[model samples]
Target: MASFQKDFKIWVMDHLPGSALLSEPLSLEPIAGDAGFRSYFRLNTQIPLLAVYSPPQEENNLAFVRVSHHFSSGKIKVPKIFAVNFEKGFMLLQDFGTELLQPLLNLDTLPQYYDLAEELLLDLQLLHPGDSIFPNYGKPQLIAELQLFQKWFVDKLLMLDLSQRDLSILDDLFELLIGNAMEQPIVIVHRDYHSRNLIVHNNQIGVIDYQDAVVGPITYDLVSLLKDCYLSWPEEIVRQRALSYKSRAVSKGLMREIKDQKFMKWFDWMGLQRHIKVMGIFARLSIRDNKESYLSELPRVVNYVLSTTFNYSELKPFNQWFSERICVCLPRYPWYSGD
Candidate 1:
């Protein structure tokens, strides 16, 4: 409270001069953050505003500014930036209130909300990505992310000392996943377009935490949505919804005419790559950052990885290794029963 009060007051005086907040008492309430270094505070004033304190060393404030502007120009419903202090890593943004789409989701509301999210994603894919300054999600980046599983989850978390043969198997799996990703159509991917990052403002979907957007596979964001790490939908339903998206993509001419089997191969492999990366990320969040709550979601993500891998003959060897060595060593939590 002491440190925040000093910085918040200075930010108000410096950025919000002559505003209504300066003339009255202001109250700031801490808002729950995600698995990141950023902190959010809601300012209880007439003007709906949010104060973000994201340390520049850990978070990219400039990327947020640039991407927010880029998305806004494309008519995407991202939070409006009011003020930014790059050096101090503070940003005052238009508050979207407390209504996140995660808690509101269920069997009844999932269809409606997911439809809206899908529509928004299509709109994103249609944009001329050449105008933006996002990174390419290429083979090297994809493999690096997968290796986080070895660095954080397998070694640090599970204490697994992988043998040379085990490492070779993983290398082959990574290549297959990377090849699948590079073969797809590229678009602006909102790398983390899950339930938690989406806001339901005025009955419309509002996007947040999009600084990591990239030019990647068309199926990347869809996998993040339908097969989200935070929540799981029935496989049949997920496939139906994914096929609906395929139809939409075909209509938009974003995807070429491919059979359902091949398209699903792309989707499943893309999701495998993501779930593998999330495993390492969640473990790192728990061990390094002391955010152990993410540990609970590890089983679900692992199940997603195993479920897909077991279905493919090429992935059978890696699946056998994970089932025999890794899966058995996983801590027995409530989600451990998933795989």
Candidate 2:
């Protein structure tokens, strides 16, 4: 055995069961392009294929285990946990191969993929606000997420040391956004339900990166999937599909009192908030963490925010602010072409 592998085996043996022998273990090859605290590796073994998750911290380990069990029991296609050593921050999981939804999305397959995603979203809505399996999406959490856009993307990424007046405008806009969110009916929200986090395995769509899931607006995950940063769909098609989702949600009694038009507004505004959050996250990943690959996707995220804001008269201030200040510094995303 190699030196690092030997050391890892010794550590695991001390902390985890059945680590006495690795059973034809292979070198730990790092999974590329993870955007979060957890690091993954493929542990090729003779007994069975396993993936390892080494979280940088242990704060969310309990939640991860609990929610994974909950979703798995609910028949959602998440990876089954084989072994977990929370103190060591290592988890051995069933290997779900990495043919993610992004490459699978073309004109012919887009509808089918989206339908599968919508089904998952419907399944998620079955989880209610007070479910013990997940965390609540309370006021403080909403405010903190909104502040990411203000702090990272608005100030840091844009390099805009805003004047007091500009700061006030930003604060007011954030309050309005959060206020709108808090007014919506809550459901289980898969906080990062985007293409890259979904795996196409054994002819089924399996969800990953769900440890951060919370109770939030019903439309939040829908918007995250359809208005994804890594992929772009046509506005007309997106609108049609979003409405289709709304109809399904209504049928499921997920939105008992909300009208279709009002639900559509909720969807749009939630998307705007999510996209703004993503822009900040992507920017922070690049600037602070020295992961510059996500910088390429910034334009698409910014465009989603811009297009959504432009659709509403009430968002005119946000629209003008972006046009006057942000647009000049960072031109329209190349994919948009002013269309």
Candidate 3:
């Protein structure tokens, strides 16, 4: 075993003395990790738990602990933290099991599960930002996320050539997306609220991978869930679900009453911002992080981008450039399909 894994096993032992993990050390099995650098191991004790090794340099372990407490206080279903050592970046947390919400979703079970998720989302948005270590999802951060597309996806992954005019057009598009996001009701955003990050635990949606929560757009997490990068759903159906959330939000006073068209524009444009940032993040995960599996999902995200690009008149120029340039280049990449 690698030195780091061995060290983590030792750390787990140090924290929990009488647990079966000490007697049966081999019961600790490596589980899959997310896009980040954290590593998780399942402890098959009398009560299952997860031993997590999250690097303090790369991850906000402090925020994770703080937000976990905050969300739990707000009656959200999150893993219970058994033990933590911030200096070493190790923790023993309640294992929510391997049942991800993504695989369980189907046409028959869709409405029920989605309704549960939406209601849970309202609970999340109701959390006060000042109650925790939440930060502003402001102009600098939004722009930086947008530039991820330019640096990783366009340049490193695709290596696209563009004229000054094309760059100008992209700037305007970015401005509009960021502007729309800034106009929304500010609340605690889970930053990565999507299907794969959610688990079905004991008949409730158990949310995870929320270390990056921030005070930002109300529609941000909603868009991330309904229009997930990992799953494909009909656009019209996704929009209708978003409207359902909109009604709940207004009723809860999470948002003011707005016209359907106006709300949709916010929803769709918010998705564009997220999808654009995700393209860069996925490209970085492939090239820099050696996780090529993220490349395979590009087609679905590309489909999302194309759908939004075509819907808005202001996005016509970028849409044409994407079709003529970006689309033409995508077919060459083995992971990309025509979608």
RMSD of 2: 3.5
TM-score of each: 0.95, 0.89, 0.96
What is the TM-score of candidate 3? 0.96
- Consecutive 10-residue window with the lowest summed lDDT within model 3: 17-26
Model 3, range 88-114, lDDT digits (tens) per residue?
899999999999999999878889889
Instruction: In model 3, state the lDDT of residue 58.
Output: 91
Residue 290 of model 1 has an lDDT of 92
Candidate 1: list runs displaced more than 4 Å. Answer: 1-4, 17-24, 331-339
Clash pairs, candidate 3, are none
Cα TM-score of candidate 2:
0.89
The candidate that wins on TM-score is 3
Tens-place lDDT digits, model 1, residues 177-253 = 99999999999999999999999999999999999888999999999999999889889999999998999999889
In model 1, how large is the Cα lDDT of residue 143?
Answer: 83
CA lDDT scores, all candidates in order: 0.88, 0.77, 0.90
lDDT, candidate 2, residue 76? 86
